[model samples]
Target chain A: MNRLACLVVVIGMALPAFAQDARKSGFDYMGPDTQAMQKDDLANPGMLSVLEGETLWNTPTGKAQKSCAACHGDATQSMKGVAARYPAMDDKTQSAIDLAGRIIQCRVERQEAPAPQREGRELLSLSAFVGRQSRDMPISPPQDAKLAATRAQGAALYSARMGQLNFSCAQCHDDNAGGHLGAAPIPQAHPNGYPLYRLEWQSLGSLQRRFRNCMSGMRAEPFAAGSTEAIALEAFLMERAAGMKLETPAVRP
Target chain B: MWRLLGLLAVLVSFDASAQTLVPYRIENGAITQSLTGVKGDAAKGRAIVVERQKGLCLLCHSGPFPEERFQGDLAPSLAGTGSRMSEGEIRLRMVDSTKVNEKTIMPPYYRSEGLERVAANYKAKTLLNAQEIEDVIAFLVSLKDDTQK
Candidate 1:
């Protein structure tokens, strides 16, 4: 009898891992009209930023006056699958850095140009352009020992309660997803379609901006832009969204 | 005299904005004493629960509200709560659910302190005032129909 009980416990522990296979991206929860809009680049408004980024890629600026094409020589070939593997380790910082962060670093260090303001049109456009290269590819977070601590911190932050509402991200996205929160359906909170446009904003925005919006909605203080906590959360989200297809420059409502 | 009157008006306005809440006592996981000392109106309580910008109760709880098309499923259904629990028990849960379950997702409708990272505009403000808490309790205790579950 005890052996049977032990076997049941072991199987119960394994159930959630198997359940994760059925995980759905926020895309699945979107209305059909929005999905159709994402499928057609012509109809999607986010493509404008991607086109701007493409122009910026070939144009030279700063003291070096060297375009990204001069070093990388065409984003289509050199940048494929690159966005899928971020927030990767930055050698200088010895911490996780997101795709946007990496772009700012390159502009400052390699191009000898000043870093663009966070969430600025320049940054958003560049990120959207680069991320567009990895569309439809699976998210592939790195499996390095160095990134483990940051990933763990991110996971903790996802579950930690904050704000006057005392809501943790997991409580809504994990525990009660598919339910309605006053007319709006609570999605699973995947980070797959970042650098994507939100209908609510009527413009393109980053994942960090979304985080701040949610934190404020919960009546809590928002994490600073580019803070370690925000990066850590991004790292964890990418890992959680591992195997999900990228939807860069995607449209959402 | 004008200066003195202006000073008094400023103090009064400041006091109103500060929102000094009523006092109450807790006993055995329940606030046996009422915060406002006056009985609450059940009709107004029902309206508050359903309103999106007020109690926000429908955001995380389903109840016997047929008109509400988008009730949540995060917490227990509010139906038949009066049949299962006493008035004081419900009042305590409204005041602060963390006292019962440390990790409850249900926001404390009446608590105003010890919260972390609260937004600047919302600091030191409870989700519901003391009288609002009583009104909600009055509405909840009236729901004695277990069949609604």
Candidate 2:
């Protein structure tokens, strides 16, 4: 009887890990008109930023005169599936960093260039270009004991109620995903379709920009782009978005 | 001359006294102690029900205001709340509807006893002031089955 009970407890503990399958990207939640727009590379507005990034990939700059192509060789092969695996835990720093943070790191250390600002156009282009390489790839940020704590903090931040509205991100994205806020539909907000174009902004932007906008919507003060809070939130969102396809430069309303 | 000096004193104290709030308690969707002189204008109430930046009622509750498009459907419609619930019931719900249902999405407009991650500047502040709650209650109660009558 004790052996049977122990087996039951062990199975119960492992059930959660096996229970979940790949979640649908916010892409699946978009209306037909938007879906059609995202499916086509030419019609998609985000491709423009991808093109800008392609330019940056080849153009040499900084003291090393090292373009992305110089070290990585070709983005089509080198950067494939790279974006999907970040905000990954940096082995050296023992902390998580998003794709944009990684791009800045390479520029400052490898290329000997000035550190680009978080919201700058150059960074957006580079991120979009890198993201485009991983288009349709599944998001699967590396996981383990070391990264778990930061990701947990990110998850807490997502559920924590903030501002005068007292709305947690879960209240909308988790509870009300695919629901309407007025005429507009709120997507589940998996970060798959990021470094994308937004009609509201009329240009390419990083995920940090969207985070700031959401903070404003909640009437909470937004953390700075590279701030621990922002990074933790990104790490959390990416973990939650595991299995969703990357749609970098996705256009949003 | 004395009246002029007294008026000056009153003006000086106005800034410090502006944030004072009248307290109330909720129990089972009703105000435990009814507020006296709680006169609310139907006109002001209508404004609060429809405004997004202030009351945010239309964000969750569909109301009878056709002028405002795209009202939410999360909560009970306020189109005919006046004909259904008593004025006292409505007042309590606005004060703190959690007394009736703890998981209600409807935010307490007049109570601030428990909330999380409120901005530093907005601590102890309710989403709507006391007068606004009364005004909203008045607006809700005005929507009677008057057309049939």
Number of colliding residue pairs in each model:
0, 1
For candidate 1, write residues B79-105 as lDDT tens digits: 998998989889879988886677788
Stretch of 10 with least lDDT, candidate 2 chain A: A21-30
Put down candidate 1 lDDT per residue, A1-253, tens digits, no spaces.
6999999999999999987786787888889999999889998899999999999999998788988888998899899999999999998979889999999998999999989888999999999999999999999999888999999999999998888888889988998888877677888888888898999999999999999989988989999888899999999999999999999988888
Candidate 1 wrong stretches, greater than 4 Å? A1-20, B1-23
- Separate DockQ for every predicted complex: 0.51, 0.30
Query: Each model's RMSD to truth, in Å?
Result: 8.1, 8.6
| Model 1 chain A weakest lDDT span, ten residues long | A18-27
Model 1 residue A131 distance off true place after TM-score fit, in angstroms: 0.7
lDDT of 2 by residue, A1-253 (tens): 6999999999998998799753666677667887888789888988988898899999998999989899999899999999988887788898878889999999999999999889898998899999999988988888666778888999999888776666788888887776666666777778888887877888777777888888777666776898778888988888888878888878777
